[model samples]
Target: MDALLSLSNDLAAAVERVRGAVVAVNARPRLPSTGVHWRPGIIVTADHTVRSDEDITIIAPDGRTVAASLVARDPGTDLAVLRVHDTDLPLADLGDPGSLKVGHIVLAVGHGPRVSWGVVSALGGRWRTWRGGEIDQLMRLDLTLYPGFSGGPLVDVKGRVVGINTSGLSRQLELAIPVSTVTRVADELIDKGHVSRGFLGVGLQPARLPEAFRRRLTGASEIGLLVVNVQPDGPAAKAGVLLGDVLVALDGAPVGATEDVQAVVGARRAGSTVTATILRAGAPAEVSMTVGERPSRRR
Candidate 1:
Protein backbone atom coordinates (compact mmCIF):
# COMPACT_ATOMS: atom_id res chain seq x y z
CA MET A 1 0.00 0.00 0.00
CA ASP A 2 0.98 3.64 -0.27
CA ALA A 3 1.24 4.00 3.50
CA LEU A 4 3.64 1.09 3.67
CA LEU A 5 5.79 2.48 0.90
CA SER A 6 5.95 5.91 2.52
CA LEU A 7 6.90 4.37 5.85
CA SER A 8 9.69 2.32 4.22
CA ASN A 9 11.01 5.37 2.43
CA ASP A 10 11.07 7.35 5.66
CA LEU A 11 13.01 4.66 7.45
CA ALA A 12 15.72 4.60 4.79
CA ALA A 13 15.84 8.38 4.83
CA ALA A 14 16.20 8.32 8.61
CA VAL A 15 19.22 6.03 8.38
CA GLU A 16 20.82 8.29 5.83
CA ARG A 17 20.30 11.35 7.97
CA VAL A 18 22.21 10.18 11.05
CA ARG A 19 24.78 7.62 9.88
CA GLY A 20 27.59 10.15 9.62
CA ALA A 21 28.01 10.42 13.36
CA VAL A 22 28.16 6.70 13.98
CA VAL A 23 31.62 5.12 14.33
CA ALA A 24 32.99 1.69 15.18
CA VAL A 25 34.84 1.74 18.52
CA ASN A 26 37.66 -0.81 18.77
CA ALA A 27 38.60 -0.49 22.42
CA ARG A 28 38.13 -4.12 23.26
CA PRO A 29 39.58 -7.35 21.90
CA ARG A 30 37.70 -9.20 19.16
CA LEU A 31 34.30 -7.66 19.93
CA PRO A 32 34.23 -4.04 18.84
CA SER A 33 31.31 -1.74 19.75
CA THR A 34 29.78 1.43 18.34
CA GLY A 35 30.29 5.08 19.32
CA VAL A 36 28.64 8.37 18.55
CA HIS A 37 30.34 11.61 17.70
CA TRP A 38 28.34 13.38 20.38
CA ARG A 39 30.28 16.64 20.31
CA PRO A 40 33.08 18.01 18.21
CA GLY A 41 36.20 15.96 19.03
CA ILE A 42 34.24 14.03 21.69
CA ILE A 43 33.08 10.43 21.23
CA VAL A 44 30.70 8.63 23.57
CA THR A 45 30.44 4.87 23.92
CA ALA A 46 29.54 2.16 26.37
CA ASP A 47 32.09 2.16 29.17
CA HIS A 48 32.22 -1.61 29.23
CA THR A 49 33.29 -1.68 25.60
CA VAL A 50 36.53 0.15 26.20
CA ARG A 51 38.67 -2.63 27.65
CA SER A 52 42.06 -1.28 26.55
CA ASP A 53 42.79 2.39 27.12
CA GLU A 54 46.17 2.63 25.46
CA ASP A 55 45.51 1.48 21.89
CA ILE A 56 41.92 2.51 21.14
CA THR A 57 40.96 3.23 17.53
CA ILE A 58 37.80 4.69 15.98
CA ILE A 59 36.65 3.76 12.49
CA ALA A 60 34.71 6.69 11.11
CA PRO A 61 31.85 6.55 8.64
CA ASP A 62 34.09 7.74 5.85
CA GLY A 63 36.28 4.67 6.35
CA ARG A 64 38.83 6.79 8.16
CA THR A 65 40.52 5.21 11.16
CA VAL A 66 41.47 7.70 13.87
CA ALA A 67 43.22 7.28 17.20
CA ALA A 68 41.20 8.08 20.31
CA SER A 69 42.25 8.87 23.85
CA LEU A 70 40.23 8.04 26.91
CA VAL A 71 38.87 11.20 28.44
CA ALA A 72 37.03 9.62 31.38
CA ARG A 73 34.79 6.69 32.08
CA ASP A 74 31.97 6.01 34.54
CA PRO A 75 31.23 2.33 34.86
CA GLY A 76 28.32 3.21 37.11
CA THR A 77 26.41 4.56 34.13
CA ASP A 78 28.07 2.34 31.52
CA LEU A 79 29.27 5.45 29.67
CA ALA A 80 32.76 6.45 28.53
CA VAL A 81 34.15 9.46 26.75
CA LEU A 82 36.99 9.48 24.21
CA ARG A 83 38.65 12.39 22.49
CA VAL A 84 39.62 12.26 18.79
CA HIS A 85 41.45 14.84 16.77
CA ASP A 86 41.98 15.49 13.02
CA THR A 87 38.46 14.24 12.24
CA ASP A 88 35.36 16.13 11.20
CA LEU A 89 32.68 13.66 12.19
CA PRO A 90 29.33 15.38 12.52
CA LEU A 91 27.63 15.73 15.87
CA ALA A 92 24.44 13.75 16.37
CA ASP A 93 21.12 15.52 15.87
CA LEU A 94 19.60 14.91 19.27
CA GLY A 95 15.92 14.86 20.24
CA ASP A 96 14.09 14.72 23.53
CA PRO A 97 13.58 11.11 24.57
CA GLY A 98 11.10 12.13 27.26
CA SER A 99 8.58 12.50 24.47
CA LEU A 100 8.86 8.82 23.55
CA LYS A 101 5.87 6.65 24.39
CA VAL A 102 5.29 2.95 24.43
CA GLY A 103 4.78 1.48 20.92
CA HIS A 104 6.46 4.37 19.16
CA ILE A 105 8.50 3.34 16.16
CA VAL A 106 12.26 3.57 16.72
CA LEU A 107 15.49 2.63 15.05
CA ALA A 108 18.83 1.51 16.52
CA VAL A 109 21.61 2.85 14.28
CA GLY A 110 25.17 1.61 14.53
CA HIS A 111 28.38 2.26 12.59
CA GLY A 112 27.98 2.15 8.81
CA PRO A 113 24.83 0.23 7.87
CA ARG A 114 24.23 -1.84 11.00
CA VAL A 115 20.81 -1.14 12.48
CA SER A 116 17.67 -2.67 13.97
CA TRP A 117 14.13 -1.36 14.27
CA GLY A 118 11.64 -1.79 17.08
CA VAL A 119 9.21 -0.02 19.35
CA VAL A 120 9.43 1.55 22.77
CA SER A 121 8.19 -1.38 24.82
CA ALA A 122 7.98 0.22 28.27
CA LEU A 123 8.96 3.19 30.40
CA GLY A 124 9.53 3.50 34.13
CA GLY A 125 10.54 6.01 36.75
CA ARG A 126 14.09 6.77 37.81
CA TRP A 127 16.07 3.61 38.43
CA ARG A 128 19.49 2.57 39.73
CA THR A 129 21.78 0.55 37.47
CA TRP A 130 23.45 -2.68 38.59
CA ARG A 131 26.65 -0.63 38.77
CA GLY A 132 24.89 1.69 41.28
CA GLY A 133 24.47 4.47 38.73
CA GLU A 134 21.30 6.52 39.11
CA ILE A 135 19.42 6.77 35.81
CA ASP A 136 17.26 9.83 35.31
CA GLN A 137 14.58 7.73 33.62
CA LEU A 138 14.09 4.11 32.64
CA MET A 139 13.78 3.36 28.92
CA ARG A 140 13.24 -0.16 27.59
CA LEU A 141 13.15 -1.11 23.94
CA ASP A 142 11.71 -4.06 22.06
CA LEU A 143 14.58 -3.95 19.56
CA THR A 144 17.51 -6.22 18.89
CA LEU A 145 20.95 -4.75 19.71
CA TYR A 146 23.25 -6.66 17.40
CA PRO A 147 26.84 -7.24 18.43
CA GLY A 148 28.90 -4.05 18.15
CA PHE A 149 25.75 -1.98 18.69
CA SER A 150 26.25 -1.25 22.39
CA GLY A 151 27.20 2.42 22.00
CA GLY A 152 25.05 3.24 18.98
CA PRO A 153 22.19 5.71 18.77
CA LEU A 154 18.46 4.99 19.05
CA VAL A 155 16.72 7.37 16.73
CA ASP A 156 13.17 8.29 15.90
CA VAL A 157 11.61 7.93 12.45
CA LYS A 158 12.88 11.36 11.43
CA GLY A 159 16.41 10.43 12.56
CA ARG A 160 16.68 12.54 15.71
CA VAL A 161 18.65 10.69 18.36
CA VAL A 162 16.58 9.62 21.36
CA GLY A 163 19.20 7.78 23.38
CA ILE A 164 22.41 5.76 23.24
CA ASN A 165 21.74 2.04 23.00
CA THR A 166 23.58 -0.27 25.38
CA SER A 167 23.25 -3.83 26.61
CA GLY A 168 25.84 -3.41 29.38
CA LEU A 169 23.36 -1.45 31.49
CA SER A 170 20.98 -4.39 31.64
CA ARG A 171 21.50 -8.08 31.03
CA GLN A 172 18.06 -9.34 30.01
CA LEU A 173 16.67 -6.40 28.09
CA GLU A 174 17.75 -3.79 25.55
CA LEU A 175 18.04 -0.29 27.00
CA ALA A 176 19.20 3.15 26.02
CA ILE A 177 20.79 5.86 28.11
CA PRO A 178 18.43 8.78 27.58
CA VAL A 179 19.84 11.92 25.93
CA SER A 180 19.38 13.96 29.07
CA THR A 181 21.45 11.50 31.08
CA VAL A 182 24.04 11.13 28.33
CA THR A 183 24.62 14.89 28.05
CA ARG A 184 24.84 15.29 31.83
CA VAL A 185 27.39 12.49 32.23
CA ALA A 186 29.39 13.57 29.20
CA ASP A 187 29.51 17.14 30.52
CA GLU A 188 30.75 15.97 33.92
CA LEU A 189 33.43 13.73 32.38
CA ILE A 190 34.63 16.63 30.22
CA ASP A 191 34.76 19.02 33.18
CA LYS A 192 36.12 16.51 35.70
CA GLY A 193 38.01 13.32 35.08
CA HIS A 194 35.42 11.30 37.01
CA VAL A 195 31.82 11.33 38.12
CA SER A 196 31.47 12.40 41.75
CA ARG A 197 29.07 10.42 43.93
CA GLY A 198 28.19 11.86 47.32
CA PHE A 199 29.38 9.87 50.33
CA LEU A 200 29.08 9.65 54.11
CA GLY A 201 31.63 7.14 55.40
CA VAL A 202 29.42 5.00 57.62
CA GLY A 203 28.14 1.45 57.56
CA LEU A 204 24.45 0.97 58.25
CA GLN A 205 21.79 -1.72 58.57
CA PRO A 206 18.02 -1.34 58.30
CA ALA A 207 16.01 -1.51 61.54
CA ARG A 208 12.31 -1.14 62.24
CA LEU A 209 11.13 1.75 64.38
CA PRO A 210 8.94 1.30 67.44
CA GLU A 211 5.19 1.75 66.87
CA ALA A 212 5.07 4.94 68.95
CA PHE A 213 7.96 6.53 67.03
CA ARG A 214 6.52 5.24 63.76
CA ARG A 215 3.24 7.00 64.38
CA ARG A 216 5.09 10.19 65.36
CA LEU A 217 7.10 10.09 62.15
CA THR A 218 4.04 10.00 59.89
CA GLY A 219 4.68 10.55 56.14
CA ALA A 220 8.13 8.98 56.71
CA SER A 221 9.52 5.48 56.82
CA GLU A 222 8.55 3.08 59.58
CA ILE A 223 12.03 1.59 59.37
CA GLY A 224 15.32 3.46 59.81
CA LEU A 225 18.99 2.70 59.21
CA LEU A 226 21.03 1.63 62.25
CA VAL A 227 24.58 2.92 62.10
CA VAL A 228 26.92 -0.02 62.57
CA ASN A 229 30.29 1.56 61.80
CA VAL A 230 31.50 5.11 61.42
CA GLN A 231 34.84 5.57 59.76
CA PRO A 232 37.27 7.41 62.01
CA ASP A 233 38.01 10.95 60.77
CA GLY A 234 35.47 10.43 57.96
CA PRO A 235 32.48 12.59 57.14
CA ALA A 236 30.14 10.99 59.67
CA ALA A 237 32.72 10.88 62.43
CA LYS A 238 33.78 14.41 61.59
CA ALA A 239 30.16 15.44 62.11
CA GLY A 240 30.11 13.68 65.51
CA VAL A 241 28.05 10.70 64.34
CA LEU A 242 28.32 7.67 66.66
CA LEU A 243 27.94 3.97 65.86
CA GLY A 244 24.92 3.52 68.11
CA ASP A 245 22.89 6.25 66.41
CA VAL A 246 19.94 5.31 64.18
CA LEU A 247 19.73 7.41 61.01
CA VAL A 248 16.03 8.23 60.60
CA ALA A 249 16.17 10.82 57.86
CA LEU A 250 18.41 12.82 55.53
CA ASP A 251 17.58 16.32 54.41
CA GLY A 252 14.05 15.87 55.80
CA ALA A 253 13.57 12.69 53.68
CA PRO A 254 13.04 9.50 55.67
CA VAL A 255 15.42 6.65 54.71
CA GLY A 256 14.14 3.12 55.17
CA ALA A 257 17.04 1.21 53.59
CA THR A 258 20.57 1.54 52.27
CA GLU A 259 19.20 2.18 48.79
CA ASP A 260 17.11 5.03 50.14
CA VAL A 261 20.25 6.65 51.45
CA GLN A 262 22.08 6.01 48.19
CA ALA A 263 19.24 7.56 46.20
CA VAL A 264 19.52 10.77 48.16
CA VAL A 265 23.28 11.07 48.25
CA GLY A 266 24.04 9.91 44.71
CA ALA A 267 22.26 12.94 43.31
CA ARG A 268 24.46 15.31 45.25
CA ARG A 269 28.03 16.46 44.63
CA ALA A 270 30.86 16.42 47.13
CA GLY A 271 31.20 19.30 49.62
CA SER A 272 27.40 19.60 49.82
CA THR A 273 26.03 19.67 53.39
CA VAL A 274 23.02 17.61 54.48
CA THR A 275 21.04 17.38 57.69
CA ALA A 276 20.82 13.86 59.06
CA THR A 277 18.18 13.14 61.70
CA ILE A 278 19.31 10.42 64.06
CA LEU A 279 18.06 8.74 67.22
CA ARG A 280 20.76 8.87 69.84
CA ALA A 281 20.05 6.83 72.98
CA GLY A 282 16.33 6.76 72.07
CA ALA A 283 16.28 10.56 71.77
CA PRO A 284 15.89 12.30 68.39
CA ALA A 285 18.72 14.64 67.35
CA GLU A 286 20.01 16.18 64.13
CA VAL A 287 23.52 16.77 62.90
CA SER A 288 24.87 18.64 59.87
CA MET A 289 27.23 16.49 57.86
CA THR A 290 29.25 17.72 54.90
CA VAL A 291 29.13 15.16 52.11
CA GLY A 292 32.35 13.63 50.83
CA GLU A 293 33.30 12.12 47.47
CA ARG A 294 33.02 8.37 47.34
CA PRO A 295 36.20 6.71 46.09
CA SER A 296 35.52 5.68 42.47
CA ARG A 297 36.75 2.22 43.27
CA ARG A 298 37.33 0.25 46.45
CA ARG A 299 40.98 -0.54 47.18
Candidate 2:
Protein backbone atom coordinates (compact mmCIF):
# COMPACT_ATOMS: atom_id res chain seq x y z
CA MET A 1 0.00 0.00 0.00
CA ASP A 2 2.82 2.39 0.78
CA ALA A 3 4.52 1.60 -2.51
CA LEU A 4 1.32 2.41 -4.39
CA LEU A 5 1.12 5.76 -2.63
CA SER A 6 4.73 6.53 -3.50
CA LEU A 7 4.11 5.76 -7.15
CA SER A 8 1.06 8.04 -7.18
CA ASN A 9 2.99 10.87 -5.64
CA ASP A 10 5.83 10.51 -8.07
CA LEU A 11 3.51 10.66 -11.05
CA ALA A 12 1.74 13.74 -9.67
CA ALA A 13 5.01 15.55 -9.19
CA ALA A 14 6.21 14.60 -12.63
CA VAL A 15 3.11 16.08 -14.21
CA GLU A 16 3.58 19.32 -12.31
CA ARG A 17 7.15 19.66 -13.52
CA VAL A 18 6.12 19.28 -17.16
CA ARG A 19 2.99 21.40 -16.97
CA GLY A 20 4.76 24.75 -17.00
CA ALA A 21 6.45 24.07 -20.33
CA VAL A 22 3.27 23.22 -22.20
CA VAL A 23 0.89 25.71 -23.81
CA ALA A 24 -2.43 25.40 -25.63
CA VAL A 25 -2.15 26.32 -29.33
CA ASN A 26 -5.25 27.59 -31.11
CA ALA A 27 -5.07 28.06 -34.87
CA ARG A 28 -8.35 29.25 -36.27
CA PRO A 29 -10.52 26.82 -38.26
CA ARG A 30 -8.83 23.91 -36.50
CA LEU A 31 -9.20 22.27 -33.14
CA PRO A 32 -6.92 23.49 -30.36
CA SER A 33 -3.63 21.61 -29.92
CA THR A 34 -0.59 21.73 -27.63
CA GLY A 35 2.89 23.28 -27.97
CA VAL A 36 6.09 23.09 -25.96
CA HIS A 37 8.16 26.06 -24.90
CA TRP A 38 11.42 24.83 -26.30
CA ARG A 39 13.35 27.99 -25.38
CA PRO A 40 12.88 31.64 -24.54
CA GLY A 41 10.58 33.14 -27.21
CA ILE A 42 10.61 29.85 -29.15
CA ILE A 43 7.85 27.21 -29.27
CA VAL A 44 7.53 23.93 -31.13
CA THR A 45 4.46 22.04 -32.29
CA ALA A 46 3.15 19.73 -34.99
CA ASP A 47 3.03 21.36 -38.42
CA HIS A 48 -0.36 19.92 -39.31
CA THR A 49 -1.92 21.67 -36.34
CA VAL A 50 -1.24 25.07 -37.84
CA ARG A 51 -2.61 25.02 -41.39
CA SER A 52 -3.52 28.63 -42.13
CA ASP A 53 -1.61 31.91 -42.09
CA GLU A 54 -4.08 33.34 -39.61
CA ASP A 55 -2.83 34.39 -36.21
CA ILE A 56 -2.18 31.80 -33.47
CA THR A 57 -3.00 32.14 -29.77
CA ILE A 58 -1.00 30.45 -27.04
CA ILE A 59 -2.54 29.79 -23.62
CA ALA A 60 0.13 29.64 -20.96
CA PRO A 61 0.06 27.70 -17.68
CA ASP A 62 -1.22 30.71 -15.80
CA GLY A 63 -4.12 31.14 -18.26
CA ARG A 64 -2.45 34.14 -19.93
CA THR A 65 -3.17 33.98 -23.66
CA VAL A 66 -0.65 35.59 -26.03
CA ALA A 67 0.01 35.78 -29.73
CA ALA A 68 2.71 33.74 -31.40
CA SER A 69 4.23 34.01 -34.86
CA LEU A 70 4.83 31.08 -37.15
CA VAL A 71 8.56 31.04 -37.69
CA ALA A 72 8.90 27.96 -39.86
CA ARG A 73 7.24 24.62 -40.51
CA ASP A 74 8.30 21.31 -42.06
CA PRO A 75 5.50 19.03 -43.23
CA GLY A 76 7.90 16.22 -44.03
CA THR A 77 8.50 15.67 -40.31
CA ASP A 78 5.24 17.27 -39.20
CA LEU A 79 7.07 19.74 -36.99
CA ALA A 80 6.82 23.54 -36.66
CA VAL A 81 8.71 26.20 -34.70
CA LEU A 82 7.01 29.38 -33.53
CA ARG A 83 8.18 32.58 -31.91
CA VAL A 84 6.49 34.59 -29.15
CA HIS A 85 7.68 37.98 -28.04
CA ASP A 86 8.39 39.24 -24.53
CA THR A 87 8.00 35.89 -22.81
CA ASP A 88 10.17 33.81 -20.53
CA LEU A 89 8.47 30.44 -20.49
CA PRO A 90 10.11 27.48 -18.85
CA LEU A 91 11.79 25.17 -21.31
CA ALA A 92 11.60 21.39 -21.18
CA ASP A 93 14.70 19.31 -20.58
CA LEU A 94 15.12 17.18 -23.65
CA GLY A 95 15.93 13.48 -23.28
CA ASP A 96 17.38 10.98 -25.71
CA PRO A 97 14.85 8.72 -27.37
CA GLY A 98 17.52 6.31 -28.60
CA SER A 99 17.84 4.99 -25.03
CA LEU A 100 14.10 4.40 -24.59
CA LYS A 101 13.12 0.74 -24.24
CA VAL A 102 9.87 -1.10 -24.32
CA GLY A 103 7.88 -0.98 -21.08
CA HIS A 104 9.55 2.21 -19.86
CA ILE A 105 7.14 4.37 -17.89
CA VAL A 106 6.14 7.69 -19.50
CA LEU A 107 3.59 10.44 -19.21
CA ALA A 108 1.76 12.29 -22.02
CA VAL A 109 1.19 15.91 -20.98
CA GLY A 110 -1.08 18.37 -22.80
CA HIS A 111 -3.21 21.45 -22.16
CA GLY A 112 -5.94 21.55 -19.48
CA PRO A 113 -3.03 20.19 -17.42
CA ARG A 114 -4.10 16.82 -18.80
CA VAL A 115 -1.82 13.87 -18.14
CA SER A 116 -1.97 10.20 -19.14
CA TRP A 117 0.34 7.41 -18.04
CA GLY A 118 1.55 4.57 -20.25
CA VAL A 119 4.56 2.54 -21.30
CA VAL A 120 6.53 2.45 -24.51
CA SER A 121 4.80 -0.16 -26.65
CA ALA A 122 7.36 -0.39 -29.45
CA LEU A 123 10.53 1.25 -30.77
CA GLY A 124 11.53 1.42 -34.42
CA GLY A 125 14.77 2.39 -36.02
CA ARG A 126 15.28 5.04 -38.67
CA TRP A 127 12.77 4.97 -41.53
CA ARG A 128 11.48 7.14 -44.37
CA THR A 129 8.00 8.28 -45.20
CA TRP A 130 6.44 7.56 -48.60
CA ARG A 131 7.08 11.16 -49.55
CA GLY A 132 10.81 10.52 -49.07
CA GLY A 133 11.18 12.26 -45.70
CA GLU A 134 13.55 10.64 -43.24
CA ILE A 135 12.53 10.04 -39.63
CA ASP A 136 15.33 9.70 -37.12
CA GLN A 137 13.34 7.35 -34.88
CA LEU A 138 9.86 5.93 -34.53
CA MET A 139 8.06 5.45 -31.20
CA ARG A 140 4.73 3.85 -30.35
CA LEU A 141 2.93 4.39 -27.06
CA ASP A 142 0.34 2.28 -25.26
CA LEU A 143 -1.43 5.44 -24.09
CA THR A 144 -4.43 6.96 -25.80
CA LEU A 145 -3.75 10.42 -27.33
CA TYR A 146 -6.84 12.42 -26.65
CA PRO A 147 -7.96 15.61 -28.40
CA GLY A 148 -5.77 18.69 -27.85
CA PHE A 149 -2.76 16.41 -27.34
CA SER A 150 -1.48 16.24 -30.90
CA GLY A 151 1.50 18.57 -30.41
CA GLY A 152 2.16 17.94 -26.72
CA PRO A 153 5.30 16.49 -25.14
CA LEU A 154 5.77 12.91 -23.90
CA VAL A 155 7.72 13.03 -20.68
CA ASP A 156 9.78 10.37 -18.96
CA VAL A 157 9.52 9.61 -15.26
CA LYS A 158 12.04 12.38 -14.52
CA GLY A 159 9.94 14.92 -16.46
CA ARG A 160 12.36 15.15 -19.38
CA VAL A 161 10.73 15.33 -22.80
CA VAL A 162 11.15 12.14 -24.74
CA GLY A 163 9.13 13.09 -27.82
CA ILE A 164 6.32 15.14 -29.34
CA ASN A 165 3.00 13.31 -29.72
CA THR A 166 1.23 13.37 -33.07
CA SER A 167 -1.39 11.18 -34.74
CA GLY A 168 -1.26 12.86 -38.14
CA LEU A 169 1.04 10.31 -39.77
CA SER A 170 -0.27 7.05 -38.29
CA ARG A 171 -3.92 6.08 -38.43
CA GLN A 172 -4.28 3.38 -35.77
CA LEU A 173 -1.24 3.92 -33.57
CA GLU A 174 -0.21 6.68 -31.21
CA LEU A 175 3.12 8.06 -32.48
CA ALA A 176 5.69 10.47 -31.14
CA ILE A 177 8.34 12.36 -33.07
CA PRO A 178 11.48 11.75 -31.00
CA VAL A 179 13.41 14.61 -29.38
CA SER A 180 16.41 14.03 -31.62
CA THR A 181 14.29 14.51 -34.72
CA VAL A 182 12.40 17.44 -33.22
CA THR A 183 15.55 19.25 -32.20
CA ARG A 184 17.19 18.76 -35.59
CA VAL A 185 14.15 19.93 -37.48
CA ALA A 186 13.56 22.80 -35.08
CA ASP A 187 17.14 23.98 -35.51
CA GLU A 188 16.90 23.91 -39.30
CA LEU A 189 13.63 25.79 -39.18
CA ILE A 190 15.14 28.45 -36.98
CA ASP A 191 18.29 28.86 -39.06
CA LYS A 192 17.05 28.49 -42.65
CA GLY A 193 13.28 28.70 -42.44
CA HIS A 194 13.10 25.29 -44.25
CA VAL A 195 14.64 21.88 -44.63
CA SER A 196 16.17 20.59 -47.86
CA ARG A 197 16.52 17.04 -49.23
CA GLY A 198 17.87 15.25 -52.29
CA PHE A 199 15.48 13.62 -54.70
CA LEU A 200 15.71 10.66 -57.09
CA GLY A 201 12.96 10.77 -59.69
CA VAL A 202 11.64 7.25 -59.70
CA GLY A 203 8.62 5.31 -58.49
CA LEU A 204 9.56 2.07 -56.75
CA GLN A 205 8.07 -0.91 -54.96
CA PRO A 206 9.52 -3.76 -52.93
CA ALA A 207 10.18 -7.01 -54.84
CA ARG A 208 11.58 -10.41 -53.94
CA LEU A 209 14.23 -12.02 -56.11
CA PRO A 210 13.95 -15.57 -57.39
CA GLU A 211 15.87 -18.23 -55.41
CA ALA A 212 18.26 -18.95 -58.28
CA PHE A 213 19.16 -15.26 -58.67
CA ARG A 214 19.59 -14.91 -54.91
CA ARG A 215 22.05 -17.82 -54.95
CA ARG A 216 24.06 -16.24 -57.78
CA LEU A 217 24.41 -13.08 -55.67
CA THR A 218 25.49 -15.38 -52.82
CA GLY A 219 24.74 -13.53 -49.58
CA ALA A 220 23.60 -10.35 -51.21
CA SER A 221 20.10 -9.22 -50.20
CA GLU A 222 17.15 -11.16 -51.64
CA ILE A 223 14.80 -8.18 -51.63
CA GLY A 224 15.11 -4.96 -53.63
CA LEU A 225 13.19 -1.95 -54.93
CA LEU A 226 11.73 -2.43 -58.43
CA VAL A 227 11.62 0.66 -60.53
CA VAL A 228 8.08 1.13 -61.87
CA ASN A 229 8.36 4.60 -63.41
CA VAL A 230 11.05 7.15 -64.09
CA GLN A 231 10.30 10.81 -64.39
CA PRO A 232 11.05 12.21 -67.85
CA ASP A 233 14.49 13.83 -68.07
CA GLY A 234 14.96 13.35 -64.33
CA PRO A 235 18.02 12.11 -62.48
CA ALA A 236 17.19 8.42 -62.91
CA ALA A 237 16.49 8.66 -66.62
CA LYS A 238 19.44 10.93 -67.24
CA ALA A 239 21.67 8.34 -65.60
CA GLY A 240 20.34 5.48 -67.82
CA VAL A 241 18.17 3.94 -65.06
CA LEU A 242 15.38 2.13 -66.90
CA LEU A 243 11.99 0.69 -66.05
CA GLY A 244 11.98 -2.86 -64.65
CA ASP A 245 15.42 -2.49 -63.05
CA VAL A 246 15.53 -3.78 -59.48
CA LEU A 247 17.55 -1.46 -57.28
CA VAL A 248 19.56 -3.53 -54.81
CA ALA A 249 21.88 -1.02 -53.19
CA LEU A 250 22.87 2.62 -53.02
CA ASP A 251 26.44 3.66 -52.24
CA GLY A 252 27.12 -0.05 -51.44
CA ALA A 253 24.38 -0.24 -48.78
CA PRO A 254 21.64 -2.80 -49.51
CA VAL A 255 18.20 -1.36 -50.19
CA GLY A 256 15.19 -3.58 -49.57
CA ALA A 257 12.40 -0.98 -49.84
CA THR A 258 11.59 2.53 -51.00
CA GLU A 259 12.36 3.82 -47.52
CA ASP A 260 15.93 2.55 -47.74
CA VAL A 261 16.37 4.21 -51.08
CA GLN A 262 15.00 7.45 -49.68
CA ALA A 263 17.34 7.36 -46.72
CA VAL A 264 20.34 6.96 -48.97
CA VAL A 265 19.29 9.39 -51.67
CA GLY A 266 18.10 12.01 -49.22
CA ALA A 267 21.44 12.04 -47.49
CA ARG A 268 23.20 13.31 -50.61
CA ARG A 269 23.08 16.77 -52.12
CA ALA A 270 22.32 17.92 -55.64
CA GLY A 271 25.13 17.21 -58.11
CA SER A 272 26.67 14.59 -55.83
CA THR A 273 27.38 11.22 -57.50
CA VAL A 274 25.98 8.01 -55.97
CA THR A 275 26.43 4.46 -57.21
CA ALA A 276 23.27 2.37 -57.55
CA THR A 277 23.39 -1.44 -57.80
CA ILE A 278 20.57 -2.99 -59.76
CA LEU A 279 19.56 -6.38 -61.16
CA ARG A 280 18.98 -6.17 -64.87
CA ALA A 281 18.13 -9.26 -66.99
CA GLY A 282 19.30 -11.71 -64.32
CA ALA A 283 22.60 -9.92 -63.63
CA PRO A 284 23.82 -7.23 -61.26
CA ALA A 285 24.88 -3.88 -62.73
CA GLU A 286 26.08 -0.62 -61.25
CA VAL A 287 24.81 2.80 -62.36
CA SER A 288 26.08 6.15 -61.18
CA MET A 289 23.72 9.09 -60.97
CA THR A 290 23.91 12.66 -59.72
CA VAL A 291 21.41 13.46 -57.00
CA GLY A 292 18.91 16.26 -57.63
CA GLU A 293 17.32 18.81 -55.33
CA ARG A 294 13.74 18.07 -54.26
CA PRO A 295 11.45 20.66 -55.79
CA SER A 296 9.32 22.76 -53.51
CA ARG A 297 5.68 21.74 -53.41
CA ARG A 298 2.60 23.92 -53.33
CA ARG A 299 1.46 23.86 -49.75
**Best candidate, TM-score-wise?**
1
- Model 2: weakest 10-residue lDDT segment is 126-135
TM-score of 1: 0.94
lDDT of 2 by residue, 58-154 (tens): 9998999999999988888888898999887789888878678999989999887898889999998887654455688879999989888989999
Candidate 2 contains a number of clashing pairs equal to 0
* Clash list (residue pairs), candidate 2: none
Q: What is the RMSD of candidate 1?
A: 1.8
* lDDT score, candidate 2: 0.86
Q: Given candidate 2, what's the lDDT at residue 131?
A: 44
Deviation (Å) of 259 in candidate 2: 4.5
Every candidate's lDDT: 0.91, 0.86
